[model samples]
Target: MAQQALPVLQPHPSCTACDLATWPGLESPGLPTRVWDGGHTEPQPKKALLLVGSHPGVEENVKGSAFVGVTGQFPNRLYIKGGNLADFADVYLTNAVRCSPRTSELVTPKAVAACREWLDQDVRVLAQCYDEVVILATGENAISSVLQRKESLRTFHQGQVADVGGVECSVFATYLAAILLPSNDPSKILAIREHLLLVWRYLKFGYLPTTVKVPPPSELVGSRVLDPSPTTKLISLDVETYGAFERNHRGRLLPRQTVFHPAKSLHWDGVQRCDLVQTCALSWRSPRGGKLRTKVYRLDRRAECDRLVSVLQRLRQCCVLGQNVPFDVLYLRAFNHRFRRVLARPHCVLYELQVLNFLQNDQRAERSLKNLSLVLGVADYRDEAVDLKKGQRYRDSSDPRAWTYNAKDAQATLLDYEFLVEAISLWYGGDTDKWSSYSRQWYNEVLWLTVQMSENGVHYDVEQLGRVHDRHQVALDWLRDRAKRLWDWPMSGKGSGKARERIIADMIQQYQPEDLGLARQYSRRVKKSRLTGKVSAGKENVWLLMGVVPSRTPDRGKLLAYRRFQRLRKVVESYTGPLLHQVSEEKKTPNQQTALVKGVAHPSWHSVPSYASDEERSFGGTSQCRITPRNPGLQTEPPKIEACRRSRFPSGALVLADESQSEIRVATGLFGDEVFIQRETAVLG
Candidate 1:
């Protein structure tokens, strides 16, 4: 079969700018007059979208065509790859400057200005050739020629939608495809593809397509669908497990030992015994619904467990909607590999409520299913007759009440899903298309990314961390002994337990300028107490001891040591201690590992305040490489922490790259801060 010919733009004979010889740069030069590239000349069924480039490159100049050379192929490839755009619409490729300059530098503002008339004429002609013509101005020169704006390309790189030559189009000031392609980063490619996808969708749909199409429940199962198709089927699932497990406020899993149990009046010994799935309750509403069908599968029998796994595998194909789907998915994966693979895309009713709450800007979005059910007026499972927390293992318990609790939970989950679906549908004015798009595209993608991030955890160095912990402990002990000696306190016995606090109290009580031989330089004064509203003798704290003491004072070293001790003590207790406990001893390798879990706001990397470690504050590395396992402040840690940097890449090698001052540059351009731009330009230059 022969290839169909592409449409080309018909040249305007009467237009003076169409003739390259008339332009200033090519007036006394030698260059081709008709530099227009290959495109459809005749009107097409669909609209034509034009991608405008700068002046022709060296290869383009030889070929006498725009976007056919090395530089032009970048956008051409993207255009074809972006949703098969060519099949839907006619695409015209052209340049701002028709005649190529003899020298690279000769393609200047004067030449661009001279060629602007021809570009404008070409756009005017193209606008008439298509029903809806859109122009994508590629670079600075192309944008300037099309938009006729004096501002540089930096101002428009963020992308703008406007009317060009009476045709509505999107201007991409940053689409330097050739430059971006060389990096070979998939993320960069994906970014460009996403932008192009948006552009193509805008051209096809008039308005940008914001919604994602939700696959129908029947379509999801396809040929595997159960007999007798129904408009709606409620599939509710719940799993009961032996042994207690819970997540902390920061979403890190803490052992029962770290958790305070008021009933037991004690904390569990930080050891978490391996837990087993006790029972799984599956409740479903059939097509011919009279009453909900419920079944409780006990893991005691091998046949029953296998049956449960098989059923779950099928349910996964459909939207296995549940409360805290990630938590359920994690346990399911741990139970069976098949369950793990199938439950990867399970929908969470909790996540749906969160999305709706976020959209409404509801600050206090209810997270717990129990709380949410109450607010949403859905059936609350917690009010059931059975004590849900009483049973340890379903095999041991013959009580029918335990099974009823499980069944009730499954039923409640299904009811919650139905209620949320209706609520969200009503919120969107019954436009399922818009609601589906927001849910699948934005909410689903975010949830999926979070799950993947949690699975791809970070590495930890147990040996190195242990060494650092010991050193900190030794230093703290020495600091305490020194403080005790300074205060002339007893070195041994029960009094030593509270020695440090006692020393601090004594120092405060005996605080005098003469004690530090600073009587001549400093004097104490009586001050009104803010809390008691009474005039009292001035008090001295660690800050005053360090800052107010004379430089020549002999006791300055002791005060500084005490301050250092306080800082190190905090680092040991609050940060390192928790982290050390979390490191798994079963791994048997010197380099241990820790994992990150997704939080409501961000991916929890277990970051800690870097200021706690003195070495971290002064180390100065180019990239941020901090890791605070079992602690919630790692992300805030500075890059200077050497231990953190080492821990980031446990294999003893580090590779880090970041966009330097990208936000500052964006702010400079957006606000048109010429002074800041000039200053940055000079400094960067």
Candidate 2:
């Protein structure tokens, strides 16, 4: 007799934070992803577990921990009132991702790149360890930390298990403990407890038990980190000056620091150089008075970038703090991108805390530094009023106002920081272990993340890419011709050199190379699926991009096409870099290959796809093929794109396959035929 499949309505354990699909790990032929084939199910998760949402604060960015933050009070409240902090079977807890994003704007691609692996790691481990993993989605930010669609989640509601490691599970949604009280139904403290209780029952034993309050803080459930000692003391900070010429809600410019000033010595772009950079920072200091003496750093030259990294390296047990850290993080990131090689590992940050408050606080009022101060009320900085505006003259006057302002801001921040730290001691953490523990359990959260995610390592394939450049000319030229043919556009060198450069640049601005390159790698597939599409997805993110360079010989090109991809399957297992995936795609599909190319793992992070196409069959075809899995989780899908028959397939290029469901022949993409599967798999016992 056919039995009815359990009415699954939630994510699987291997689904990561969002129940979205993802590769379990980067063993081989693995790619980052958020969605699973089973889709979202309504099945129950392993029982006796706690679900901790992601926080946008110090713990997350600075310490690199998931929960156990100031904002964690939201989930904490649930436990305090009804749910048990560790009442679950194994207390399976995780965010949608392991790391916080660099930008507050949350570009679709970046989000996927940053968290795909985190999602997969948690789910895969949990799935193997428990039969029912209870998920306590603490609002959208928390939910988004695990789930893919952040804006669409409802507070204090129930979720159906949609998918897992191609399995089923269940999720119970609830208001983030951060949500303000006294407004909504769950607005009342009593109601908040009630919601938590319901979630608790749902998580405890698959079926909802008519409980009324959260189980007692689940018996000191998790640990923050495994290591007994701290990693390093280096933090990156960004400041947003209060007195600025900005008036618009979108952070406008009105001669404010954000606005570009010709007189400003910091040669930078956008608000960073103008307003953000104008902001000051607190540097290495020694305790002098009631408050520690501080050093204010004003980056007047490019050398400051290197100097900052130097400071981070020098400080062994210190942590960096800042307001709205992304500003500072981005600057550092840009430096890394431009100069090549950023060995900097960030520590605590004030900015990460502020952003998390925006997502976790659940308040209607503007969540600013002032509001944060008000909420914490840890100090009396607001009362101390000095004619701060008068201090403006010193900003551009070249006297010493800038340094003063930087010093003052840093000191004031330092005072508040002390309070924030003391306050943090009261919070309990989950997960213990250096490699896996959430840092908050032991030390600062954001600081830990910086170390765990340190540019672990970067590798590139130069020989493989050389071929990519040769065949990419025609496409590059065509893109230019299209631009030149337009109305008042200039005619590039004889053919279309200038046109090519501009158009290609525009395309680089886009993640998809199909639009600018000779090959049509279904970028739409990436966009629609929402993958990170990065190089290191299997490890950090799930999305990967591959290219099919024209082979040395016609037959050789053909054989190298898929065979090359198969070879890469092995190297990708070892390199484990970031992926450039789309938002929706990161939720489910593995790295969508743009093309197939032989891969070699070297410590060089130089990989740029050619912006041109080919005329004489760019890539030949390959007959000798090996099968591999595309994602991280269970043995699923194929490393090879269906039966990828080729004619000029270019590396980092995508082509369609399977008429009814054609996919981009992404190089390093997966096939589940088993060639890449590991013979010795680890089981959770």
Best by TM-score: 1
TM-score of each: 0.44, 0.28
**Model 1's lDDT to the true fold?**
0.48
Put down candidate 2 lDDT per residue, 163-263, tens digits, no spaces: 54453556555455545443423333433454465555555545543211111222111122111123333333444332332322234542434211211
Residue 218's lDDT within candidate 1 is 30
* Residue 620 lDDT in candidate 1: 22
Local distance difference test values of all predictions, in order: 0.48, 0.35
lDDT of 2 at 641: 20
Model 1 stretches with alpha carbons more than 4 Å out: 1-236, 244-275, 283-295, 315-317, 345-361, 381-399, 421-436, 488-559, 582-633, 636-685
After superposition on all C-alphas, the RMSD of every candidate to the true structure, in Å, is 24.8, 22.7
**TM-score of structure candidate 2:** 0.28
